[model samples]
Target: MVEGETIDTASLDGYVPFDSERQQAYIDAGYWRNITFHDVVDRHAEEIPDYTALVGPHRELTYAELAANSRRIAAYFVGELGLRPNERVVLQLPNCTEFLEAFVACSRVGVIPVMVLPRHRSAEANHVVDLTDARAYVVDYGRYSSGFDFVGLADDVRSSHESLEHLIAVTDGETSSVDGCDAFAEMRDERWVDKYGDEVSKTDVDPSKPGVMLLSGGTTGLPKAIPRTHNEYVFQWERMADAADVRDDWVAFPGVPIGHNASLNCIVGAALWAGATVAVEPELKPDALMAFIERVGGNYTLPMPTQILDILEHPDLDQYDLSSLEVLVSGGQKVPPRVVEEAVDRWNVGFCNIFGMAEGPLICTRPGDDVKVQANTVGRPIAPEADEIRIVETDRETEVPPGEAGELAVRGPGYFTGYFRNEKENTENFSDDGWFFTEDVLARRDDGNLEVYGRIKDTIIRGGENIYAPGIEDELVEHSKIANAALIGMPDDRLGERPAAFVELTDDATELPLKDVSSFLEERGIAVFKRPEYLEILESLPRTEVGKIEKQALKDRIVDAESK
Candidate 1:
């Protein structure tokens, strides 16, 4: 299932059936362009030595500076600490300069870096660290609430997994901070020179070899590991960059965490791959992100739906200087068209609706897509290989009509090789015929545009009638009072599972009446059956590691509340 092995040169000629023939230019150029992410970094360091690679409020690292620091870190990882290729190095830090250093360093030296989201507490962290059999774990000693101690977490990981040995603490040492644990400053040594430097410069760097281990959010079970190689990553980046219309001078403001595919695949790599500047914002909070964007002189921004709503509703949003932001790319959640419409109409910016998951298709807005499609539609397949990519009938295994909603199954060059070493799960995830079932429902509009319906798994069977959640949530976000909305099915004694709307409200939410939501949806012609039977208001809806609305968490909260 490796990209190099599975996808032959001949098979790729007609690979992208859904895409225009113009996309062949990218593959023709990158086909044998075979360079690891590390190779790109090393090339950039030498070529664009003085250019600012990353800029943030906390620190600024140039291409040469970031590469130098990463080399020192790579030395510590390989020389003193004895890290090896194919070994798992768990990175559990928020968006910061350190994450970039460690992640790029690992890629350079070929040690597999598994991204550990900052939201994971000790228990959840331990579960993933244990499952991955990670040799080392990296974290910020003093970060966030919960008094999340790096030393304590390290000890817990060591106890849980016999393979765990190193626990590198960033920030705080003697002349620098920390007692027993290794100081991050020691690894950041300036004197260290490149040793496995060929690993970075060599064109022979195996793109088929495993490079990153992206963890599933444990939605169905404990998160399964998916290994992405260098070549597959190249394909992913080309497709994403193509979709985003990334130019050499384009600057990207990554609102999503860099570790996740949204930022890493599109923002980080797109910048490097296209020779553009990237502004790494710390949090998705509206003010902070826009402030960071102001400082970095950004041209492009990729914010989620809620983050957009926050900006649209922010009291002092008008104060920020966002005239430099030429493009706004939104993904990782369903975008309510109205929220996007308001932002576009008011802020004078067009919305790019990107839809896809880590394990499969990456549908995003392209240059040729109409303004309505760019704002309203998710998009068509952007891959050079798409043997099967469509919304098909769930009841009969038949391809649904263009406008009908059904499951999305696809297989292409950008698709993951397979889940990391999970044979049984891999067999089940992909169909026997070979298409990777996305478990998402989508509709192909009459104009050849694609609109995401909702998660097929998230479908609420209310009294045997299926109510897709995204359609309902989309209408819910249209109201001025609502910030974010998620609909989850709850067990009804009469109906198998009834749709429940879990909502997060804006600051001015107090004034809106309950009927306002229902009336708005009804006027828009949203079916009565799709209307939620219950509405739960919260400060915020729980999110997965990828920042997706955690409907399962809402379901648990409802059950817990009902039990009490």
Candidate 2:
């Protein structure tokens, strides 16, 4: 059951954060009747037609105008391109206005969209596109990074995929172009805005049809394509938005890659679901983000943990007047205690924790949570606690005791139905009782709050004993000399496996070798048995496209290095 069942029938413009009871009261009403992900923007298009819904570095589209552009793109899709309902389209691009335009257009047309990270190698996108049998694709063909020719890669994908019929190139304010691709400019030239605007109506939408496909991190093995019905994610956004104080008057800054589930589902999607505005472009540069925040009197920012650390450590941190910020959320990684400490004690803002994932419900700190509580635990369960949120022991999916680590499984209105076209995956992920297995391991803290304990698939089994990486990681962060650490199990002949520590240090800190780091941990309460055997410190850790430390990548590297 999709959880977002009419939380409020009141005007969205006046909508503000509501407590659990009021939230349920609103839910008891029909605020969400006949609504889906597409419905959010459609309602906004009618309610606040003239308001700015999207702002990019190059273009700004009002709600009505966005709808107009989306209609045109949708028409191009349905009429010219002949994209069918529930058919898949691949959108791979950096944070750009055109990506949003095309994505929204797909939603309006009832086409399922699969967002591939723009940083994907041509080979990766090729594999995904082939697997999905994508009907069309959106790319930033002329983009250049690391001096690689994006156009060349795009061309290769178009040639390689048999079902890939259309390639729409979204440009970045430059005239230079890629040949053999349909440019975004062509749509305007073809009067696509006038031709497609409102051309397709929502006559056939079921609200239960699959709308988006999110690929898992493939941490344990191959990436699985998780398909979500429109209503499932819509319910997630509506409830989470109401809980997180998302509203029309609020301005949110999401610096993470929009392609990630955390950013799209919880942060930006929730914001838009409530008629709130996100910053024009996702501000990556701290200075630019600060400027945008100052410009809009922005109240909310939910940066990745490392990003927040960078912001806190910036030499010019004192120069920015961020008085506009009312709340800060840290997730996708653990927030350094010192960073969390300063964010609240010094900044005097609501520093909160957001624990979330693609296949599960989200938990975020409410407005009234104290700084200490917010810093200590990720959060309590989100309400309309109609959903089943439980931490189960290893062998079976039954509830666990406090302070005991177990895998998390949730059954709720916001949970996904199944993975796309993968019955085998569905069989493994869902239980006979109807709960979706999130596969994320977590622990209930002493205070009855939950702290995510890392992926169950990433767990280390050494000599028949299981080790959770996050436990060691949190302890590693507590070390005064350490900046950030990731523990990955390396193969050991006798023990079967052992742990390794990969540390990324502060800019100016002297290099601490493995021996010294081990000594520091031993001097603390960490037992010798738990200490990492091999510690490697390099310049920086490699991150996924969305800024998450790609442990798989790191593990692969470690394996390669050891073998060499």
Candidate 3:
């Protein structure tokens, strides 16, 4: 869940705060709990209003119909799209129930959404609507069983952004209008929820501003905006739903990308701030997510070790009835400890291990850790006293010694108060006394957990989709038969990595297949899971005597041609 892009408004002077003695030491260590995510869906819709909060693939909402469908889509985004409060739309919907009623109706009307990924088209949705000047783009009305067309890619990103000016969509039946957009079934019409469903009162809301922007799977271009505020995502989804014990009669499921950031701060913002029950299922198919967890008794999930090796190699893996799961976790990359010891030796299911980042550092592995330290550590710091974690050494202040590996960094009330309007990636990824670094690498172990030693930036990650490699090697040397490009990441026991480009040609080029580099990165709109699944033609790439590119000598020539 390493996505990227950024921008914003609702004035906290457009943010990058955290300095009043690091925001009152994260509000005196109560981890800044000033509330607001529509005050946890209006205090669980007045305390568990008939529980079952959201199931999707058709229906089942309660928590008073997910807080009255997020206050009737926050009164159709401020009384029929006049949208204000800090306006900045762009959602790009998909794990439907209108993507959690337009992400909790853009946090009950202080609109800031900007998520971007139903496999983003139109050059990463017109570079996140030219970095969040977004005044509505929404989507989800037709084609995407790879027929592509998300409402004709949000009308070609609203005819190449005219400050976008509303487009909406999200429908399944006759709410009519499809091309001129605006029809999330007319905001659940009860005559527009009786004229703006009490327009989202409680003094508009501030929970220390920002409330959702996240994108940043960045290492080079097109992805850089990780805002995340509402009191730092309610202290990172209620301390990662109390470090994955997540109960309010848990059900979860979040098979990733319900606007990611590890499915919103680890499983639908910790199952809607722990009132639990999320479910959703539009695609991440392991026999349709084990038939939507044997038809919805889900019992928690997270899946991303190549979807736990495609649901432990589904050859109809014992024809469903996953014994109501009860915890699985896994995250972006680095996770094979036998897929956490064969999904906890089959069915007693506990699994675990997370490690996040949009611009924050979530790190998990809890629910009673040891299955070999939840298959080789990742645990610890689900706010270990409001995050500090260092390790260091390529001099981001030196430290690195105790069983060393380096790079991780951190520093936070769930880290992020930078990179919104770039300022050169907020000064090359923050650290003049603020930290964030995370070019990964890790290693901590003497029982304090950590481990995963890899990345000092030049990401790839594949099936859990990070894919940076110089933004597809700057669109593979702008292709005219390429003259230099590199990409990388090959080993894929089911997508734990895939890309592999390499290039070099152009001098009356010769050959370059992998379907002409996946139809020239799908006509340059890119994201068909960031294209390039193998295409090595290089007569020159391995550089570094100062020229750089020797990507570990092209990953030791795909590990010496897969050991012959």
Among these predictions, the greatest TM-score belongs to 2
**What overall lDDT goes with each candidate model?**
0.71, 0.71, 0.75
lDDT of 3: 0.75
Ranked candidates, highest TM-score first: 2, 1, 3
RMSD of 1: 5.6
Minimal lDDT window, size 10, model 2 = 9-18
Candidate 1 lDDT (Cα, 0 to 1): 0.71
* Candidate 1 worst ten-residue window by lDDT: 11-20
What lDDT is obtained when candidate 2 is compared to the true structure?
0.71
* lDDT of candidate 2 over 1-564, digit per residue (tens): 022222221311211112345335435654334466656887889999988777666667777777777777777787678776667798876666676677777887677788787667766778777778888887775442324556577678879878888877765547544566677755543465455444456336545556677777644345666666666677777777776777687877667667778778776787788787766454466776666667767777677777777777788888888887877877876655567777877677876687777765677766568767687677776654555687887665568998888888876556765665567777887776657677788888887678777787678888888888877887887776677889989889999889899988776677788888788778787767678998888688887645578788778988899889
Residue-wise lDDT of candidate 1 within 1-564, one digit each (tens)?
Answer: 112222222321211121223234435655425667777777888998888877755678888988888888887786667766667899877677778788888876667788776666676678777667788888777632325675677777777788888887777333465655666767887544455433333312345566777766534446667677676677677666776777767777678777677777777777777767777655667788778777777777777777787688788988998777766778777887776677667756656678867675778776455666776898777663542476678743688988888888776556764676567776766665457777788888897778887777888998888888887887787777887888889888987887788888877766445566678888989888777777878887887644578777888888998899
Selected candidate, larger lDDT, 2 vs 3: 3
State TM-scores per candidate. Answer: 0.86, 0.88, 0.32
Can you tell me which runs of candidate 2 are displaced by over 4 Å?
1-32, 142-148, 172-178, 188-199, 218-222, 282-288, 513-515
Encode model 3's per-residue lDDT on 227-272: one tens digit a residue: 7878888888888888887898878977866777877778888888
TM-score of 3: 0.32
Cα error, candidate 3, residue 499 (Å): 49
For candidate 2, the TM-score is: 0.88
